[model samples]
Target: MSQPQQSTVRNRLLKALTPSDFALLQPHLELVATELRQPLIKPNEPVKQLYFPEVGFSSITTQGSGGKVEIGIIGREGLVGVIPLLLGSDRTPHDHFVQGPGEMLAISSQAFCGAVNESASLHKLLLRFTQVQYVQTAQTAFVNASYQIEVRLARWLLMCHDRLDGDELRLTHEFLSMMLGTQRTSATLAVQALEGHRFIKAQRGRVTILDREALENLADDGYGLPEAEYARLIEGA
Candidate 1:
């Protein structure tokens, strides 16, 4: 893989870094392809590559009595495999995998740690991003606990829309059900509800956002807080 041009980099965290901070990790950053459903990191396994996604999104999930469910979405906004590293660990219990197909700027765990240790500013920036994750996960918990299936689906869709390049999301009902921690029938019904409201048009394998504002209004407290936190902490920092 080749090194990515700084100006052409699309990852929000990478784009937000100062020249000096970016320079510290530039030599080790390798642009790599990410395929749909590819496992980026596995539970309790040593994390080898840290990916800063440029185009696609990743699902951060865990499994238990409730079954496997996603907790956070890492897209162009953040990096994976660093949360454990930042906390002085080599791995995590959470599962990380590509949900969308695209490219990621990847680095080895060792090199990433070296860079983080070498620059106080870089470390600060990454810690800020970590905080963003905390906010997102917390919001996910709140939304899932407080909202109905349709509202939760709307919130998840809005988050996916924020990460991808277009309004059309290439997610099937089964996949959406897995992410939302609901049954396929429930997810299908939610899709019908959203389509009925003209907020989205759902097909067999794709969903197109037709009225984003309506979805936002419908999902009022289900989303936005964490996104606002991201903008305030990382985008502006």
Candidate 2:
């Protein structure tokens, strides 16, 4: 079947596509609006689609008897469906949810597997992406274990800022509580503390960075690694 003319969507990865690569998968690339708080994959559910986020953040979470905690966040630097691609697994042990709103390039799992099998460039890219995910998982564990809540929040905001390419973030404290595996009261307190230090300005659902340099100083050492890795992986792509 003939592929459609390449899409001109705003997704960084989609836009970076070479003409030949874009044409080869143009018919399969469906542009979809990713909604915040939407569940991309249920825990322990079948992996049916691979999402290439163009402008949003998706959180990979592991749930316990208490609640869910975010283990990693993926944006334009990586793909969302790594289970099927790397382990040949059909199901996801973790839940995938959208943390921010933006456009995504979503393709079916079968199509993704086919593309990987057919294209050496794609296979290599996916493998490198798998490595990035590993790094994020490790860093998240380090952050949760060794860092204070305020520092962790700074790191989180910095990571989000790096992806969003802006200083302002639209989010609610309630959702952030879930992401951080903390109580809502705790989250509120953290936000207030950050605000007091002029690291962020929080009003209603929006939080704007006031002094990133100070935040970076407070973010601890592990925080900068992911930001640097993102720069190396996706800058100018």
Candidate 3:
């Protein structure tokens, strides 16, 4: 298997690692492809591999009384399977899976934990992401509770847009319902609302951004805090 160097990796988390810390992990990191809906962390199952996606993203979801609710999004800007480990657990109650197909640099949890235990700097750097998740989840909860379906949809789209490279998002109404924790009909109506405003143009299974700034305004305070927190903690690292 080919090992990827931290300097050449697009994952912001890997890129943020110091050279010494990177060296500790360089030997173990292998390039791998993650397929859509492929399970990474099954609820209550041990998280054996950690992934730093170079492209695409994954959804960290949990069971809610209503059904599955997406709590966080992990992409090139973040790492997967780190939360349970950072919190001193081998497993988590959340389901983590690929939302889209992409290549990622993956390492075994054993090697990942060993490197973190060996380097205080590495451990500290990775831990900042844990804080970023906390903020993101809290923001998600607040937005879900306080905002209208249109507003909530806008917030969700904005988050997805942040982790992607292009303006078009490959998403369906049912998929969006799960992400927003709303009914499918609600999601469709919201999509129409955004399209009505020319904020986005919704196609069969794709949505293209027409005016990102307007969507941001519609999302308003529902967005930006967690992103700012990520910038302050992870990017600044």
Q: Each candidate's lDDT (Cα)?
A: 0.90, 0.78, 0.89
Query: What TM-score does each of the candidates earn?
Result: 0.97, 0.88, 0.96
Best-performing candidate as measured by lDDT? 1
Tens-place lDDT digits, model 3, residues 111-207: 9999999999999988898888888889989998999999998988888888788888888999999999989999999999999999999999999
Ranked candidates (lDDT, high to low): 1, 3, 2
117 Cα displacement, candidate 3 (Å): 0.5
User: Model 2: runs farther than 4 Å from truth?
Assistant: 1-19, 233-237
Measured with C-alpha atoms, the lDDT of residue 118 in candidate 2 is: 75
Residue-level lDDT of model 1, residues 1-237, one tens digit each, is 567767889998898898888988899999899999999999999999999999898999989786889899999989988799998899999999999889999999989999999999889889988888998999999999999999998899899989888899888888888899998899999999999989999887999999989889989988898888889888882
Clashes of 2: 0
Better of 2 and 3 by lDDT: 3
Error of 2 at 222 (Å): 2.4
Q: Pick the candidate with the highest TM-score.
A: 1
Which sections of candidate 3 miss by over 4 Å? none
